[model samples]
Target: MREKLQHVAGRVWLYPHDPDPEAIGACVGVIADDRGSVLIDAGNSPAHAREVQQAIAAEGLPAPRWLVYTHHHWDHTWGAAAWPDVEVVAHSSAVDLLTAEAERPWSHQYLRDQVALDPKLGPSFRARALAVPDFGELAIVLPHRTFDDALTLPTGVELRHVGGSHAPDSIVALDPGSSVLLVGDCYYPPPFHLRTDDDGPDLAMARRLLAEKHAVSVDAHSAPRSGS
Candidate 1:
């Protein structure tokens, strides 16, 4: 919960992830150009989103005109509602799951009930929810736009769906201007919520890496790795 936005390059700024296991949060990116600015992920809650906005504003950065999701996970998509003015975008496959979450009441009790019934909604997830100033203010905003394969923004950012074990609907955003690839959590193992030991996605990801021959692989939760 600190003002930690780091400039990656040209038009890319990264808000690094919070390392606390109990209330983890993923990295977020801001890519801006004359056409418009785009937010890579919405953060974990309304407060988290607000903090990002404030950080950008404090630095005199352009306010994001679009918010994109890498996948439909609480840590990534829960703060969508905070950026009401920006259009929310995600992969086509993420719509159903996100829409279902959007229908749920935004309250601590509701989340507690879900935790009791679903192992996937584990304690770590709940801890983050509790960290929110007002859990009732939590909201799941659905995507305003979606793409099956790729979408090229006016700013020259490319978003491509690259399904992986972490989340099938995972998408990576590449800022051509900066050569920064926002891979979200796709490179990581299934999160704590899923609690699985499946490495199938890892193998598939390796194959994808070989097929594309990417120069480097940047994970949302970890440092960049050499794709070579």
Candidate 2:
């Protein structure tokens, strides 16, 4: 019900914390420039995506030049196809993971189960999803271009692959102009049930890198964290 877009610095904008009921997924970030804007992550549903799009336009910015995904989770990728025409960009494995999930029974069940489990989301998200009945329509638009490692935008935005905790395919976008690093679902607090493929070394390594980085860093669905 209550959604906020926080201007961390320069041109970086983050929505309410990713875990918020209204968000229903990770946080949303917007990176804008004179040429065009870039969406850090798509929301979880059509309604969610619409809100994100509206928020951007409300800011008087044009449609995003690219919709860069942090990972392939349903909360991040499901609403992608709902977005206005923009090139989707992601790690090759992210697209593969998206395609693979489309074929899984559990993927569809996540909706039904979440409604039964998460009280806040049930009324707003599940009820609406039930009204539609065609769960398959949520099929996302796949990334047109794939990259193995880092990809630099023509506009000079740099996205670096950062190891993740919630999922295997996490990456961070570096906006030099904004002096911000967007760590999408890459850092999670403790006592969490979500499991990651990474063991001790890689996850620890990622943490070290994040700590050493000097730019202000924000999680996929969080407020701006100080660079220190």
Candidate 3:
């Protein structure tokens, strides 16, 4: 799949999700500001993350000074090590989940074993993890800062925790200037790997926010849309 960044708003750019490849990573957002840009989520792997960095440079935007996680899902947080210089941020609930994942050993054999033993670790996930040449290099860097409810950055972006069935730590980043909301999978249905019948929650919070103040809503795994 071609890796490219799509401008969604005046100051918001999105690396959209491509479904051509199975187990592909989610969409990532870049909020550009004179103060210093902010990243929505790390890519699924180091290689994937590097693509984002390359795209940013190609567009002549400043490298992100901060990295924010929408949730603690592997696809969203695994590439964290790629941006070591940035101060990472996430919902307070994500720390423990990320810590647990970080404690686990990452290796081809371990991933295969998990897939065999745990229904949640399906084949697609294994394939995605294996895409990286060296599992030993995979790392999940925990957030350097966290918030329970909402926080605003100096760049004028707002981070808000709006937990839903998709994830208890689900959050969104709102760039008021652009009227764009970067909603991490907070509105997506549960993954098939989870093997749960529950589809998930509605995007009421996201809808309300957009309806109240924004013009565009960017989903982690879908193209940016207008009118909520």
Candidate 4:
């Protein structure tokens, strides 16, 4: 079932609540107006992608015109293939990661672990997921537009690409009118695990970034927090 997060204005739908916490990472974003909507990050698989699509549809908003990848993690970018012909945007470094030749081995290993941990993923789904080409093979269709620092799309939404914090090309989105910020993976609450491969900025810096915006901030793993 899709879980909806309530906000004073607009709403956020979180995806995949299966037994395994990492099975399908959540996709976050808002729905408003008729021109279209914005999606923060795509989920882990095509199945998760469909769930996100359905969630967005249920919100009664137009199909997403712009989809932003908060980072280039396989869990975040793989489902992008299911999003159709939307204008996908990401940081320049994310684009590079998605287009790099060395991504497949790491991506395959990650997906394999996710599938193993969640038998709910099943064999057929695992096969299909494994078949999809890695980021380097599908970069052309994945993220067509890339930005360095900050870029604003239509509808008063601004996406600021902050240098590698959680990953090499992490980004955060801010809706000035709503004063809501969508940050993926950079600010997980408590019980923090220190993994060697985790790159980019630290949670403290992420907190500082949220503080600077003075917007209500939502981390990828938890509910929204007051930026103040």
Query: Which candidate gets the maximum lDDT versus the true structure?
Result: 3
TM-score to true structure, per model: 0.87, 0.78, 0.92, 0.73
In candidate 3, what are the lDDT values of residues 1-228, reduced to their tens digit?
Answer: 346788988889988876655666787899987678899999888878888988998889888999999999878888888885898999999999899988987777777788888767675566566557788678889999999999998898999998887788999888888989888888776666763665654667655656665688887777788874
Q: State the lDDT at 87 in candidate 3.
A: 89
State how far residue 92 of model 1 sits from its true place (Å): 0.9
- Lowest summed-lDDT stretch of 10 residues in model 3? 194-203
Candidate 1 similarity to native, TM-score: 0.87
Which candidate's TM-score is highest?
3
RMSD of each: 2.5, 4.9, 1.9, 6.1
lDDT of 4 by residue, 43-144 (tens): 665556777787667756678888888887656766777888678889888766777723445455666775687655444345435435453433323488
Candidate 2 displacement at residue 71 in angstroms? 0.6
**Residues 51-144, model 1: lDDT tens digits:** 8888787767887888989999888987887886898889999999888877867576777778888868776557666557586677778888
lDDT (C-alpha, whole model) for all candidates: 0.78, 0.69, 0.82, 0.64
Q: How many residue pairs clash in each candidate?
A: 0, 3, 0, 3
Model 2 has an lDDT value of 0.69
lDDT of 4 at 62: 71
> What is the lDDT, from 0 to 100, of the residue 72 in candidate 4?
75
lDDT accuracy of residue 96 in candidate 4: 66
Pairs that collide, model 1: none
lDDT per residue for candidate 2 within 33-102, as digits (tens), equals 7777888888776667777777777777667888889887666776687777778888877877788877
